[model samples]
Target: TAAPGPQLFLSLCLSRLKFPSDLDELRELAETLKFYKQEHYGYVLLLYCSAYLYKQSFAIPGSSLLNMLAGAIFGPWEGLFLACLLTTSGSTFCFLLSRAFGKQYVVHFFPEKVALLQRKAEENRSSLFFFLLFLRFFPMTPNWFLNITCPVLNIPMPIFFSSVFIGLIPYNFICVRTGSILSEISSLDDIFSWGTLAQLLAIALVALLPGALIKRYGHAHLKVDGLDGDGRDQAGRHRKRR
Candidate 1:
């Protein structure tokens, strides 16, 4: 069973003193952020950027919270741009770090998943761009999991970065838009209403279209290449038999 809201709130607040669990606290934060933005704009920008990168690179929590804050601070479009840029940069850092230090340890821990991902990588090497984009778009895999495992699976850097940047746009825009309206929100329910979910689902469907098309069309070339090799082997074997 789930804990009571107050109990969960208390536990979360105790663990992270700055985590805003209620609308009142979020409103307060918004006001404070406005003052800081007016007073110490450059310094605050640097701090926010550094903190965002550090959290993502180290696999820490608070990215969603930061995205919300970005919407509140920078407004929707600017916040979305900044969030996407930082997310891609931070994920790239994590990817490179995992390749160097954590790949072996991560592979040891998640052997089956790693093997499955590697097999998928081999099978989709030609259309890996779309595959990675779909993976990034959906929540089937966690970002941290992908960051570490992609290196082990030998996915190239360009594909990984491109997917992260493009795939994050829809969800990032949602969170940022929520932030832009944070002051008017009365409860969590308001933020994730049915309307919001439908919009997100529509966006997710759009994101998947490219991957579906690639799967449908990209296999023909691979099949033709395989057939050519098979024909050569058949002719060689017939010559030997004769």
Candidate 2:
């Protein structure tokens, strides 16, 4: 067996690529993987994979493994950047796609979930990016539901992308670091070791720190200083808030 798993994955993820209906191309791709497992090139592949997955269906299964692969192939820095960028881009693409597709699409694809979206819509409706990030954070919720409905409901794109990109940083960092660790270890058992889990947890916290800071700062700054319905600070010079 040539071990073309990643190659097949790479090809499959590209929405633009036309896979043969016969699925025979997968065999050749697999065979080719046995030989083309270049470290540098693989890093690039991982980035493409992450982004493409986001673009195609927002299904980033095995994201930890992919991130670990990134660390293994790119050795951390470049790998981290690639993983984060692609993940963010993919997420943003879905948010935009929601705008174009309409409510029926969301209903069909995400029929099972739609409850708390109203609260979220009210809260982050004003801020797409943060709302998406908040969605990404405590997410057992249906993503596509939010994506499609956001636009129809009149949410702006800037807020959606910004929140998603920033909010998702913690999770993405954890996934990427996991991939790096996988690259480091010799077997699957190592992946279950306490150290790996600890490392991922640490990275997740680190990534979240900035978002927390921003949140705190925003809350601190957003106070209207008892200006009634809005406008003007304590002294009354017209204090506009976020």
Candidate 3:
């Protein structure tokens, strides 16, 4: 079994919001957010909270909920862009946070999982870019660890960002589309959260598949190199024909 993504998503989602028994509290919280004056701050804070939960096994829950809220709060294009920004911005925060702490921190927060991740990173050091691409594509790999380890491993930010942006496109589109529909649908059925989640996962596979195939088939055709003519060779070190 691939595991039921919906049940997993729902279980993860509900786990985060251990709400009050009273509907009044719910209403109050929702109203406060709706009327909150510092909209951007709240938005960023929401993202920051997501970053805080980075160590949690199932984090898609928070990110997904935030997108729906972003649509409601910011509306359409602005909301869409803001959602994406929050995601990446939160990721940046997690990256730096984890980097500062190092592997010991990862082991503390996520012993079993982070160990697996560290092993994977070591295995993919030879294909650093593709390794990053794979992680960004599926997102099971905690991005927090990636951000922290990248600098430690001397992986350039340019390579990281290129991989992040390209590999994240499908996920971004999924969130954006979900937000757009959420703007129109004010109810659970209309929200289509379950369906949208499934669709997005499927779309993720669909989007990543082509790229994977192309890379697998055409890796030789694509060469990654530094600006120097001899990529691995040090040009500045050359003492011209002495």
lDDT of 2 by residue, 1-242 (tens): 34345556467446433322322443333233323555335544755474446543453334444454545555567767866776666656666666666556555543333323544455544454444554556443434334555665566667766665666667667756665665556678887789887886788777678667755654553321221212112112211121
lDDT of 3 by residue, 30-130 (tens): 33334442433444355434543452222233455555555544554665576566566555555555556664654554444444444555656777777
User: Of 2 and 3, which scores higher on TM-score?
Assistant: 2
TM-score of each: 0.69, 0.56, 0.51
Best by lDDT: 1
Clashing pairs in 1: none
Model 3 earns a TM-score of 0.51
RMSD of 3: 14.8
Candidate 3: clashing pairs of residues: none
RMSD of each: 13.2, 12.1, 14.8
- Which segments of model 2 are wrong by more than 4 Å? 1-47, 54-64, 108-115, 123-129, 142-145, 187-201, 207-242
Please give the CA lDDT of all the candidate structures.
0.69, 0.52, 0.50
Candidate order by TM-score, decreasing, is 1, 2, 3
TM-score winner between candidates 1 and 3 = 1
Number of residue pairs clashing in candidate 2, backbone atoms closer than 3 angstroms, sequence gap of 3 or more or interchain: 13
